[model samples]
Target: MAMNRIADTTNAVEVHGVVKHYGETKALDGVDLAVPQGTVMGVLGPNGAGKTTLVRVLSTLIRPDAGSAFVAGYDVLRQPRQLRRVIGLTGQYASVDEALSGRENLYMIGRLLDLSRRAARLRADELLERFSLTEAAGRAAKGYSGGMRRRLDLAASMIGAPRVLYLDEPTTGLDPRTRNEVWDEVQRMVGDGTTVLLTTQYMEEAENLAESVTVIDRGRVIAGGSIAELKAKVGGRTLHVRPVVVAELPSMAQALDEYGVHGATADQAAGLLSVPIADDGQLTSVVRALGAGGFGIAHMDTHLPSLDEVFLAVTGQRAGGTDPTDPTDPADPTDPAGTKIEEFAA
Candidate 1:
């Protein structure tokens, strides 16, 4: 593997005051970001919020109008060739050739990265096994499942053993099961020390994989922090108190209010009293109130705000909408006519 070529640096990626404009439309507006080495940093936003634009800039696929970026300790502008050597990118769609066998797809990328014929074959074999494609190594990718194709594409990106990876909404259009499979592969790579920048709108995906996240909107970063921290910032926990019988819900709500637990609402259908609490102290009060009132507690759960809730709180809208595509963010450069792969080899 060529991963040993990676530079020793505290942060695998750093961007400062990056600005990219597509004519009059500002795609990125003075965005700054940092990803600590060997961690997964999730870049989240609604559609057309510059998630892909940022990834393109970091991967050297497109240059920002102003500001600078460095990936794997190589300047994105002055040392793009060196940076490309240590980074891999998998875009929204699978980039594998449908005509090629799974093994051929990986081998071709290995060869494109300048591996010798024997070395390319060995690397292809290793990745196929690692990604669980060994059983279908000889089958054409055209017949592969969506999950299989995604895995193959991920394997191709790893052929050069890149020290950093950029995944731009890699789980888009994937089923839950398929997305979980991709998440597993990504986790495995991170376990071996590859820093990853993942751009996605799926809250569950980011919550599962990212150690920290940067939330962007309208071409700017609105918030950035650990999941728990962000959740705490957005809202407090919801205390759900389910009673043993439906008739007890009204009494439960009344008792909670009498005990100084304000904003308690009863759901008659589910027979639960929902209270929004700021901290654990309120939870103890609620427990004591229910016990003192002789309420039979069927279940109780305290749920921190979900990522979707956090997204809405930060952006003032949901994490996804039908936003028109920005002209500058072209289709994956891995197209047959593009030079992305060849540049990596160079």
Candidate 2:
């Protein structure tokens, strides 16, 4: 796992004008975000966008150079000692003790959190059962599978029943099935009223769990909203058409622009012009306008914007190429045929 992944999380964590710098590099620059309670707040950005840095600040591992942050009502900088009590952190790698049994590890964490010996034992057992690690509770961490260790780590995080949880790319390398298991555990956490903050570059992961997202680039916010809202900026549903006659290009482009279409892109080489429309009705409007102009339409298609488009439009980075850890992430949109997308209009 990279850090940790939150599943169907609910609630908010806020950062206001948060800034951090390393030497001459500004890792975070006047970044502001609001995540409502009971909702997954996915922070999407490329490498060096200060995602991990922001996570470190919010988790109280490092103090910010400017601005303030709050997690579940505690100030991240001024009250880190108090903040740590209400938040749980599960990084990419499991933080459990490899020399001890899972039961011992969880119990130790509970004890460190100030639980009585008997209470710690009970809490450890309960968490083991909660995460389906009961059967392996007595086994040393080194003997556990990748998934088991992660579950143990998550259980340790919950020792204090934190109000807010920070999951930093929780499933980077796990198999699909194991990842799903971890996701299930996160869902249960939100069900009990824990707010979650997640930082991930995985588009599918964000789509599956986040209700809204804040995308950053170069330590600044590039976009922030629900997936639909972000896509809307890049033309939620785009209409692409080509005129069989080259002479119709200007007329088509003009008519579409006159009709109030926003940001129409043209590829004259292919005799193609594309514009983002509000919906199918606008597609009808374009077709009507073109017909009124006597332009013969060769072909037209309408499609929803992909997340890759959103990333590219805002960050100037392809989703695949940005993650330095694995540049060949197949989830990118640079494939020969583009992403396999559903045609909204034909």
Candidate 3:
């Protein structure tokens, strides 16, 4: 492997031609990604697509077989010790100790990161209040709700005020309200100049939080861009029309096809006709044609291709499942967080 590519100084995280393997398995085959400073880059893929392996490499939990990666102005391979200090990682499962109190967990992490006892205590108290855990700060983590433990784990990651945070499925099984709370915290971190790389199975979460997204499948990137850019790249807006009379569906399809509109499809079960529209002008033309044909519309709307649809079209698979190579499993000895504090202090 050769380091012929120049680093992108503006990016808080940059990876190029990264490859990793397990026995004969090519978990990551030449994956490339970049996340600009102070923004979120969503990594999406089906199970076993190497999403977690890439995270482990970037976080310095494991080394890549080839290529290069730089985070927070430090090379992941050459500057791993320095890199560890400026980065925080939270995996799919909450890694906080259940026997410890919420406040104690944060304080312990702070202390391990080399904060003075007084400083660690102050930082713990600050985070407990910031994450709205002050009321339950003294309670053992085992007794806390799922959402509470999640917030505490997140708070632990921020104890060192990292410059880059890696959140790998941070909101996996939480309810909607708790998920939104986690989203809010991520936004706040980015607002304060911390870069974030998020990997998740939820399309809505990516749409709401990611400034840009990169889709990977089978250890390679299939698509990469902002939500709008990816949607446009996949296909243009689709016009959905539901006629008031179920019997008129056939007529409506014929009318649309006759109006020079191509690829119009009818779903008999939903009683709706969908066609891809090239532009707003075309949408208007279709509406006028429908009106002139005496077709009464019950509902009509147009929207760009959704992330979920884009993912399926590009990867030929749905967005979520278990990634066998992912070390988020508690039993996996290579779990990134296993020695998080020690690595940070080193």
Name the TM-score of candidate 2: 0.68
Question: What is the C-alpha local distance difference test score of each model?
Answer: 0.83, 0.77, 0.82
Candidate 2 C-alpha lDDT tens digits along 138-163 = 88999999988888989999998987
Q: In model 3, where do residues sit more than 4 Å from their true spots?
A: 1-8, 236-264, 269-308, 315-346
Residue clash pairs of candidate 1: none
Instruction: Quote the positional error of residue 58 for candidate 3 in Å.
Output: 1.0
Q: How accurate is candidate 1 locally (lDDT)?
A: 0.83
What's model 2's overall lDDT?
0.77
Per-model TM values vs. the true structure: 0.75, 0.68, 0.75
Question: For residues 84-122, what per-residue lDDT tens digits would candidate 3 score against the true structure?
Answer: 888999888898999999999998999899999999999
Instruction: Score candidate 3 by lDDT.
Output: 0.82
Give one digit per residue, the lDDT tens place, for model 1 in 83-194: 8888999999888899999999998898889999999999999999989999999999999999999999999999998989999999999998889899999999999999
Best candidate, lDDT: 1
TM-score of 1: 0.75
Ranking by TM-score: 1, 3, 2
